[model samples]
Target chain A: MRTCLIVDDSRVVRTVARRILEELQFSSREAGDGQAALAACQEEIPDFVLLDWNMPVMNGLDFLRALRQLPSVRQPIVIFCTTENDINHIQQAIEAGADEYIMKPFASDVLQAKLVQVGLL
Target chain B: MQAADFQFLSALIKERSGIALSSDKTYLLENRLGPLAAQRRLNDIAGLVAQMRSVRDEELIRDVVEAMTTNESLFFRDGKPFELLRTVILPRIVAARPKERPLRIWSAACSSGQEAYSIAITLLEEEGLLAGRPVEIVATDIATSMLIKAKAGVYSQFEVQRGLPIRLLLKYFAQKGTNWEIAPRLRSMVSFRQHNMLGECAGLGRFDIVFCRNVLIYFDEPTKKGVIERIAQVLAPDGVLLLGAVETIIGLSTRLEIVPGAAGIYRPVGSGPRAAVA
Candidate 1:
């Protein structure tokens, strides 16, 4: 079972994603914000990280940047989950090393495609 | 406007955003850029793009992109989901748990706090469910601006009416001109914060009833798998997973034994989590 880290600040988003993941058959972990996410990583490293873009106390972009800075933590494959649909924002996420970008209110099929696109599936 | 320009624009939008614009939205694109192009005295979008690349007004680039991103939100747009929460879900959750255990509920993509507040109103009404109890809701979102707004707990009347009932509007909220603020007591019941669906969920502990409704459908298959796996980790064994009306876990994981008689509910079959069993 692949252990995954859900990095987001919204509890509901975390819960919903967690529920979906449970249905998918992968073991999961969660963090509420970027700061907490980093801390969670220390306790138990995850196979993949689902990073959100906007947040307090370290947004997703900053978190991704910070994650790259640490050499000890084995980096997980990440996909940017956000509602920002601008070209530059998408390019920026890709530039920041995100394997893919997903929009908000997306259907499960679309999310699955993005996962496969990024090779995490 | 031209065939090639429209194709380029569509490709750019698709690449940058997952919104699948229909073929008839050509004028909508025109509307988005017309004012700016007119203000710059440019004859057309080509002139504007050329000028933008030359002078590179970074703010303009940002503004344009920001405008394109969809931030549309409303209070309780979907009534049936909340109906399930107040009527069917909460009762089962309370009955399944041991006494004195704190009830934790999460609202996944809590846009501007309305959904969380809606839950609060519903909880407040069910006196016996939480008469002398502790039930804290953790409301989170990925938008910083929205989180700030959610924390404020204020909304215009128009913002309130989308799904708010009149009884709730009168009782749990206070009038502030055209806007209404959810009562302080109701506001305090929820812990609002910034969260992304693609990261770690720490310090949140576990939840009995999770309202992660209608936030998925944006990720890829692997991301979905990864998300489900993580959710299973923190969920209490019998904890119920509530998804959007259109969402499901049919092709997903094996951890959750699909609960019979429930449309969108799933739970762990065996002993919940072995790590915490002892």
Candidate 2:
């Protein structure tokens, strides 16, 4: 099964993401912040990463840049999940190598579409 | 059926129900109406059409039209539009409405009442925002069979399983043996009626938000334009219209414009043609 790394600060958010990912038949590991996420990535690269924007100890953009520079050859398809929806923020996230961005409070359909767009499902 | 019978049936359907049927739909007619033919003891579609042409049987005509019109729908089908309704449209309308006036929503061509009930679920979930404001959900459909099922608000497990989230299924539904029924209170929030889209809509009154999704694609250009024109009349000045994800009013009507940042959502243009359908 494909593996996913979920990086989010809120327990509720992480739990919801995990449930949805697991339902999609993905094995997952979680990190509370970007530092932990980077460490996990260094240990083993996941096929997908559902990253949050506003976590402490290293924000999402910085972590994304660091993750890209990892010595590992495979690059996980990153999806940035956040409440920020303006054009500039979305553009910046795309430039920072996010495969897609979904607004918070999205239903499973949206997640499924994003996964399909990224060819993960 | 022969080509002549197919042509007659297509013309009859268009005139009766405003549904434009093309030659490609011969298979569709065969698939959907073949059993109706057997019940009527007709040899085939050609025989059914011959009987209808000869006698103009009203019941057979109704059955034929209803069968041809697709009623495929599910709870929360294509989730973004509902998300937009819950997050943006409802809050905007509530904040703008006067204190005493109740919010009105119409699910036009509401198939099996899932669209209307889905709207109710959203309103119920956002009770804190409502703050005692009243809300009415009016759902209308052309198919009486679908209306009956919609009014009952009951579904088989397989029906509920499609497009309905597990969390919502647990919260708003009660188990009836192997099936599930919508809670009485939630079912009561919506009112269903057997109203044809081609008929007068003034009797339904005005609505703040109208869900007319996935209904226009079946119509010819003229019928589609006519239906949308009538819809524009019954919509409140500031109200919005939500169409199917693939549908749009861009080429069909000039009175409505798509809302920026929201796909398939539209608002009426004040300066455009507002002439009533004669």
lDDT of 2 by residue, B26-97 (tens): 899899889999999999888898899899688889999889889888888888888888878777766766
Candidate 2, superposed: residue stretches over 4 Å from native? A1-121, B270-278
The residue ranges of model 1 lying beyond 4 angstroms of the native Cα positions read A1-121, B1-72, B269-278
True contacts kept of each: 0.00, 0.00
- Model 1 per-residue lDDT tens digits across residues A44-113: 7777788888888988887777776767547777777776644456567767777666657555554555
Please give the distance, in angstroms, between residue B268's alpha carbon in candidate 2 and its true position after superposition.
Answer: 1.3
lDDT of each: 0.68, 0.85
- DockQ, each predicted model: 0.01, 0.04
Tens-place lDDT digits, model 2, residues A1-121: 9999999999999999999999999999999999999999999999999999999999888899899888788899998888764445656877788877775656776677668657788
* Top DockQ model: 2
TM-score of 2: 0.71
